[model samples]
Target: VKSLEDFYDMEGFRDKEFDKDDKGTWVVSSKIAIQKDDSSPLVSKNIYLFFNKNNNKATGKFVLSKIYEDFSKNTENEYRIAYSNNKIELLDNAPKEVELFLKDYKFLVEEKSFKSLNNLPKISSRHNDNLPLYSINYLIKQDNEINKWLQQKYKFMKQDAIMNIENSGELSNSSLSNFYFKVRYKGKKEEIQYFRESINFKPSKGGY
Candidate 1:
């Protein structure tokens, strides 16, 4: 069985320095299981490796993003994560070696009523026109390819597997749960092996 380390190696992540010439930014996200407070249940917290070009070298910082909690109680408590301004070098074409010390994230949430009393109004509307157009199309095409492969392998009727995937939220060990596993396993094994060696796969625990 493949582990999370294997998944990261397969993804081919590079330092933000080589990513874009104009934007000069790149971000990769991952989720880890953790408890928010003593009384709260464990939830997957989102973390990001954010990199941006700083002069000739790329600097990176580990950011602790927010989590979706208290959903059953119909309250969204915003978490404020604080981190130092310290950053590490992760430049492109440089020796892949760096040490970074991540401080423990501090979570803070103020009362909802307190915000309104202070004259801070929430902004609800956002401009969707600026969103990337290709991402939705790409996911749709991938889903179609996966569904096509599944139907051919299992003799599933049209739209049957698609329905199962949509309705199978958080159901582990089922067809929907194993969707990611299927994506990696769908391609030809020999071709994947050849490609993997070309990229120089080295498993490291840094930046994760």
Candidate 2:
């Protein structure tokens, strides 16, 4: 495997503007004007793709960062579709495990077969911090209800519950947007358009 320093010193990326993060991941940064036409006060984005070098292979499993500036409300969001093992992993500015778990959970609940899990997709974000302290009783009631529901389901529900505890958390709008972008980008890329049509890609909703 080629070391981080060695990979950065290689061709193409030798003089390219990039950074080595604390974890020694190579981050290639770039910016693109996302606005349509020569619109005034143009909106652009700073995109960063993190990679881990292994011999001649580079894994983009690290986060692909997208920072937008002065974006318009009417502008439709676009995302780059990641296929195979090149799928994005960490999302910037959040807990990596939580983000990945939520992303995969969304995929499992929405895209996977109905037999995957009963009532998994119905998980909602109705509970808020503003609730009264006495809500603890209702919270425990909720937990008992969930436990009963799981007990009535598959033998693997225990492990699933454990994994949820370890990896799940409140899904932020930005983190969720990162997942949306990776799965569906309506950009000028021909390959992306091809995949959108071939895969019959459509944006999903209401699976928090």
Which candidate has the top score in lDDT? 2
- Give lDDT tens digits, candidate 2, residues 39-76: 33334333233333323323322222323344543343
lDDT of each: 0.26, 0.26
Error of 2 at 190 (Å): 31
Which portions of model 2 show Cα errors greater than 4 Å?
1-23, 34-47, 54-208
Q: Which stretches of candidate 1 lie over 4 Å from their true place?
A: 1-23, 34-42, 54-70, 74-101, 104-208
Q: Largest TM-score belongs to which candidate?
A: 1
Q: What is model 2's C-alpha RMSD?
A: 21.2
Model 1, span 9-55: residue lDDT tens = 22232333333433232232323333334445543333333333232
Give candidate 2's error at residue 59 in angstroms.
4.9
Clash counts per candidate, in order, are 0, 1
Candidate 2 residue pairs in backbone clash: 79-185
